[model samples]
Target chain A: DQQVKQNSPSLSVQEGRISILNCDYTNSMFDYFLWYKKYPAEGPTFLISISSIKDKNEDGRFTVFLNKSAKHLSLHIVPSQPGDSAVYFCAASPSTLYNTDKLIFGTGTRLQVFP
Target chain B: DVKVTQSSRYLVKRTGEKVFLECVQDMDHENMFWYRQDPGLGLRLIYFSYDVKMKEKGDIPEGYSVSREKKERFSLILESASTNQTSMYLCASVRPDATGNYGYTFGSGTRLTVV
Candidate 1:
């Protein structure tokens, strides 16, 4: 079963515009959500994260909003630059167990920011 | 800065061959994970180790085994390779936060082809 899902396989946005990537999760037990950006042939780098306790978290140009009732979350990048073009993955973890740090990840959304 | 390193960037092996993928983390993280990423499938966890000599099977652990003899190294072993195992394999390590939230530091990834 896919607990986390990224419905859109690809997204395109013009530079200087806003780019929004969405993610949905079927597991309510997940309390922490993170977004990672990956470039071709490189490892995924951490972008931003939000805890379930908070509805939103902002980190400079990136903002993540979580709606627990809807089991959905979104990452928004303002003034999207060409450098922002990459595959973005949404991952979640349930903090119920102290020793468990496994993350469930979405299929990923390929974002293309054009000039 | 945390660095996770994978031994190989690419490898080609024949079916039924035993393959070993090595991962090492500079940070003394207690949590280490192995995942396989494929088209439209995202990243599926193969195994994880929380501490030295301790391990747990993740979502897709079949046909794969892992060893964490030392806290800084985690290795994934394919008992017998298959064509279906051809994909990008990722290694990650996490240092847990006070709230049990983890931000993963990932390796560049190893692309394995089973011929």
Candidate 2:
């Protein structure tokens, strides 16, 4: 069973515009969500995250919004740049502060920022 | 900065050959994970260990085994290679107690091909 799902396999947005990537999860036990950006042939890098208790978390140009009632989350990147073209993965964990750090990742969404 | 290193960046093996993929973490993390990435399947966990010699199977564990003799290193063993197993393998590590401050760090990944 796929607990986490990224419905869109790819997304395209113009540079300097807002890019929104969506993810949904089926597991209610998951309370912590994270976003990772990965370039070709490189390891994934952490971008931003939001806890279930909070509706949104922002870090510089990246923002993550969580809706517990919908079991969905979205990552919003403002002023998207060409450098943002990469595969973005959404991961969820049951609990992070108490040692349960096993992440369940989504299928990933390939974002292409056009000039 | 935390660093996770994989033994090989690429490997090719025959159908029946045995294969081993090694991973080492430099941050003294207590949690390590092995995952396989395919074209559309995303990242599927094979195994994870929270402590030395203690392992738990993830979503997909068939044809694979793991050994964690030391806290810093984890190895994934393929009992018998198969063409179906050809994919990109990723190793990740994180502190078990890590929360918002610490997230999982992944290696560059190893692309394995079975002929």
Interface RMSD of each: 2.5, 2.1
Cα displacement (angstroms), candidate 2, residue B111, comes to 0.6
Q: What is the TM-score of each candidate's chain B when compared with the real chain B?
A: 0.96, 0.96
Docking class of predicted structure 1: medium
TM-score of each: 0.96, 0.97
The residue pairs that clash in candidate 1, if any, are none
List candidate 1 segments past 4 Å from native. Answer: A96-99, B99-102
TM-score of 2: 0.97
In the range B6-109, model 1's lDDT, one tens digit per residue, is 99999999999999999999989899999999979998999998889999999999999999999999999999999999999999998766755547889999
Best by lDDT: 1
